[model samples]
Target chain A: MMRVLVVLAVVFATLPGVIVVLASLTAGQSLAFPPQGLSLRWYEVIFADPDFRDALLTSLTLATITSLLAVSLSALAAISIVRYRSRATALIEAMLLSPLAVPHIVIGIGILQLYGYFGLRADLLTLTLGHLIITIPFALRMLITSLAGMDRQIEHAAASLGATPRAILFQVILPQMKMGLLGAAISVFILSFDDVALTVFLVQPGYTTVPIMLFGMAENQVLPSIHAASVILLLASWLGVILIDRLIGFDRFLFRDGPSG
Target chain B: MQVAPAIRSSRLSRRATSLLLLAPTTLLYLTVYLGGLVMVLVMSIDVPPGVDSGGATLAHYRDVFGSAPIGAIVLRTLRDSLATVAGCLLLGVPVARYITASASRWKGIVLMAVLSPLMVSAIGRIFGWIALFGPGSVIADGLTALFGGKPTGLLYTEAAIIIGLTNLLLPFMVLSVASSRAHFEEDMSKAALSLGATPLSVLLQVELPLIFPGILSGALIVFSLSTTNFVTAALLGGSGRDLVGYEIYLDILVYFQQGRGAALAMLLLVVVVALMALAIQTGVQRHEVRDTAARTRGT
Candidate 1:
């Protein structure tokens, strides 16, 4: 009975993704199951469209920048919080991680209101700011874990060996945290790339991210090209997952710390 | 005593260095995230015509609470979220048990395959549902042939939203349960079996009680996620069936009523956080009790 339930649940959980991939391969004009013929015409179509291309470019650029910024910021914060052990460390960490507790939609609204209040325009900078709030927590948590798990003896030994702080950071600390930094970067990229709820509010007219564009398509008219775009995103995200598996082991990263994004 | 001054200076320098390291990100969060949330709270109660011109008012809250349509939407959100939680529990427990209990070589691969859907964007996954639940779709056709009636579709219905949400969040449930199951004692089950307890009885009487905290936490996550989910509900529930999040979207984006939107958002946030705090409180207390019981048993 348990076996049957697991099978059913797996199917229920995975059927949508499988269907989406299949539907993206439809040779016919519209999306349908059991495609009239199988082809990559939809992928070609979406790729050829300038708007989709622009959105894709924007999402990639945004994800790259956001992830880099978030990881770098978090790497610094992790160092301080783990090494300093100040009374305010817990509160500061919680403040950084509070985005996970708030809904993305609320974050969007809050940021939108903040922009309006501050007279900030809804541009890539502001959008990156919003993504930072969402992505920072994930990066921070991963880095903190890696930092906490590291052997303090090694750092002490480096210090006693007449190593400078910069030398310790560059030669000792970063080399050990290469996997954590890489994993955090990949995870944050995926989160930023897939983010829609917050990105929707941040985008001004004619400036849509890939997920937001797909969201608009889903609401108005879901072309097979939308499915194609989705397939592209899925593949990109899977590529990230594979990289993490190679680097840090997927199960250890995922189950050990809960959901990535 | 000779090194005391040097140690104090090093401590001061360490404090300064740590502060320097943490300053930029801390400042950014303070300005944007903390500042933005405070703005939302202020906007929710601020009277119209201007933020600076008016005293704080509860008109938006009153509007949200007193409106019948908004009430109905809230009720629907709660009902669907609860149903999604129930569905996840039913499917998630068995899958989690399978993951934890199986010693197969393919365990990691199977787990990855089961969870890979979480990597896909929500819009992508929902588009697949749009295909499956549409008229003349595979599900509709299968049901028609099986039941011998007109084709039935679940598109744009409450059931569709429930299914979509359950699928979207099942990974979290599985992760939670499997993590908890990692620490489960195999000896207790073996001991129960040796005492002539049926497998089903052992599962129900011993295992479920032990893992109840996992289930509770999973339910809380699923419930909170589904309730605040804008994408699935927006896509599956369609127009006029907006969840609270979607309703807030319409109010702020479409209708341009920031006050009402802020009010609704705050209400949703407060309720979800309150439930989480309450559940986590009980969950932690229960975990402590369980640990104490296990210690006593060990002694």
Candidate 2:
């Protein structure tokens, strides 16, 4: 019974993705499973469309900026929260994690209204800021776990040798945190890249991320083009997971238990 | 504690430097994120300039609650979220337990399989459902042919929306459950069996209590994600099963009712935060109980 359940779960999980791949291969202009004939026509079409290309570029640019910003901020926040013993630490930690608890729709609406007050409209910058907000908590949490689990003896030894605080952080602590930082960076990039809810409100006309573009296309009509996009994204994300796992052990990063307290 | 003060002053300086490093993120959260949330709260109560000619009123809130259509949408959103959360927990916990009990090599592959869904965007995954369950698709056609049933597309149905949200949120459930499962001691199950308990009884009487906190957290995350989801509910729910998230989107974008939209958004936010707080408080209580038990055992 247990084996059957596990197998069922795996099959169910993979079914949608397999169908998406098969649908993308259909030669029919409209989506139909059990393809009339397999072909790369839709893939060619996606590549040829300047809008699709531009959306992909925009998504890449936005995700890159969001990830960089989230990583740096989270690294600092994680260091402080882990190293400090202060009254404000718990409040600050809760405040940072509050974004995760709140719904993205609310955040999107909030951002729209706030931007309206400043006469700022939805654009790449607003979208980036929104994604950054959502992504920071994940980055911070991961890095904090890494810091908490790290050996403090190296830093103490450096201090005993009369190493400056800056030198200890830069030369000793930073090097040890590399795996954690790399994992956090990859996860943040993925979050920013895959975001749709927050981006839905903040995206402007003529500027759409890949997911937003796919959403627009799906809403207007479900077509083979959307399947092609799904296949590409799935493949890209799979590649990203594998790459990150290779760079830093994925299991350690993911399954690292949080602080006991 | 003499050296502790020197150590504390040095740590304080280090923390200050770290704060400087975190300045940009703090600015983004305060100015862009939290600031935006505050703006939405203010707008929720604000009466549109032309409509009321009055500055602010609770009229929008009254409208949201008083209207049958809007009220039904909120209820449907809550119902669907609860259903999805239940489904994910029922499905995810068993799968996670199976993976945790399996050999180390299988664990990695199983974990990846579970988490791969998180990589795909919700939009793309919903589109995948669109192709599978949309009119004239293989799944729909197969159902009709096999059962000699009417050709009804499952697209734009509440069931389809729930299924999509479950798929999107399942990874979170599995990840949390599996983490907790890893920490379970092997002897508890053996001890139960030695005491003449059946396998099922051992699982229920011993393991379930230990892992309930992780399960609760997973359920809360999944529920919150499903309730707040806009794209799947909008794309799959059609007109019959409008959720609060979809209504907010439609109000702002389609109807141009900014005040109503903000009000709906605020309501959803309040409910979701309250739910989360409740879940966290329960989790903390469980933690305290576990700590007390462990300490008593130690003595």
Candidate 3:
């Protein structure tokens, strides 16, 4: 009985992805499961549409810049909290992690109102700021975990060998934190890439992310081409998951008190 | 706590370095995220310029809490969210136990399989449902053939919303349960079995108690997420159903009623936070009771 339930749950979890992938290959014009016939026509159609291409580029560029900033800013904060103990460290960490407690829809509405009151244009910069607010917590947590687990003896050993602080940091510390850095970067990238609720509010005309575009299209009518676009995103996220598993061990990453805490 | 002599020589510099490293994140979080949250609270009560002498008003709050239609929407949202929580817990516990009991190699693969849904965006995940259950699809066609009636589809139904939310949130429940079980020792269960306890009795009387905290926390998370989730409820439940998140979206964007929307958002935030606080309080009390029981047993 237990085994049956597990198997059934697994199927329920994965069947949606399987059907979407299969249905995206439909030779038919509209979206439907059990494809009328198999063909690559929809994929070709989506690729030819410059709007999909532009949205993809915008998502990529936004994700790239957002992740880079999130990682750098988080690394600095993580280093300070880990290396230097002070009365304010706990408060600082809590404040940084507070964003995760709020729902995404609330954040979207809040930022929308904030921008409206301040007369700030809803553009790429405003979108990046919103993305940064969400992504920074993940990056900061990963780096803090990595830094907390590091051996202080190594830094002491380097200092004893007449190495300067800069040399010790650049050569000894960063090399040891490779996996943490990579995981944090990938996490922020994936999060910023696929964000919909927050992105929808901040997006302007002709400046939408792929998920938002797919959302708008799906709301009115779902063409088979939407499935094709979804497949591309599915593949991208799948690649990120595999990369994290290879670099950081999926079991360790999943079980850690990371985002779900 | 002995420091290296070379590092100890520059105490002031170390303090400066720490301050420099901490400043940017603090500044950014405060200016944007925290600031926006405060602005939303203010907007929730702000009276429009032409309405009633321009002082702060509770009219939006009154509408949110007092209106019949809005009250029904709130009740519906709570019902659906609770149903989603039930679905997640039902499916999640068995899967978590399976992952925890499996061997090392299988554990990695199983964990990945469980978490794979989270990798796909909610849009992509919902698209799969759209294909599988939309009109003229295989399931609808088969149902129509069997029943000799109108074609039956799950799209835009309450069941679809619950199912989608459960699938999307199962990973969170599983991860929570699995992590809490990570440090659990099997010897206690083994000893219970050796003392003439049946397997079912052992599971119910012993293991369940040990993992109850996990279930509680997981349910709290799943419930909060289910309530606040906009995309899944909106896409699957349709506009006519009107969950609070969707209602807020329409009020702000479609209807241009910012004050009411802000009021609803703040109300949702308060309910979620209060529930979390209540859960934590109960969890702490439970821990103290358990600790006292253990102490008594020791004596």
| Best candidate (score: DockQ) | 1
Candidate DockQ values, in order, are 0.57, 0.56, 0.56
Please state the CAPRI-style docking class of candidate 3: medium
- Cα lDDT of model 3 by residue, B1-299, tens digit: 55776677677678788878889889988888888888878888999667766668888999888889898888888898889888887888888888886655555566677776666666787888889888879987887788767775778888888888888898878876765565455666798899999999988997787677778877888888888888887887887887888888888888988889999999988877776666555456555645654574569
Window of ten residues with lowest summed lDDT in model 3 chain B: B285-294
TM-scores of the candidates in the order shown: 0.95, 0.93, 0.93
Query: What C-alpha lDDT does candidate 3 achieve relative to the native structure?
Result: 0.82
Native-to-model Cα distance after best TM-score fit, residue B9 in candidate 1, in Å:
1.7
Q: Order of candidates by lDDT, top first?
A: 1, 3, 2
Better of 1 and 3 by TM-score: 1
Candidate 1 per-residue C-alpha lDDT over A1-261 given as tens digits, one digit per residue, 9 for 90 to 100: 988888888678778878989988999866656556899999899989999988888899999999999999999999999999888777788788877778888888888889988888867799899999999999999899999999989999999999999899989998998989999999999999999889888897678788888888876775788889888888888798888888888877776543221
> Tens digit of lDDT per residue, candidate 2, span A166-217?
8988999889999888888777887778777888888888888888888778
Residue-wise C-alpha lDDT for candidate 2, range B24-113, written one tens digit per residue: 777777888889888988888887776847667898888888899987887898889888988787778877887677665666676677
lDDT, candidate 1, at A130: 93
Candidate 2 residue runs with Cα over 4 Å from true position: A257-261, B1-15, B146-150, B289-299
lDDT of 1 by residue, B235-262 (tens): 8888988898899998999998989999
Winning candidate number (TM-score):
1
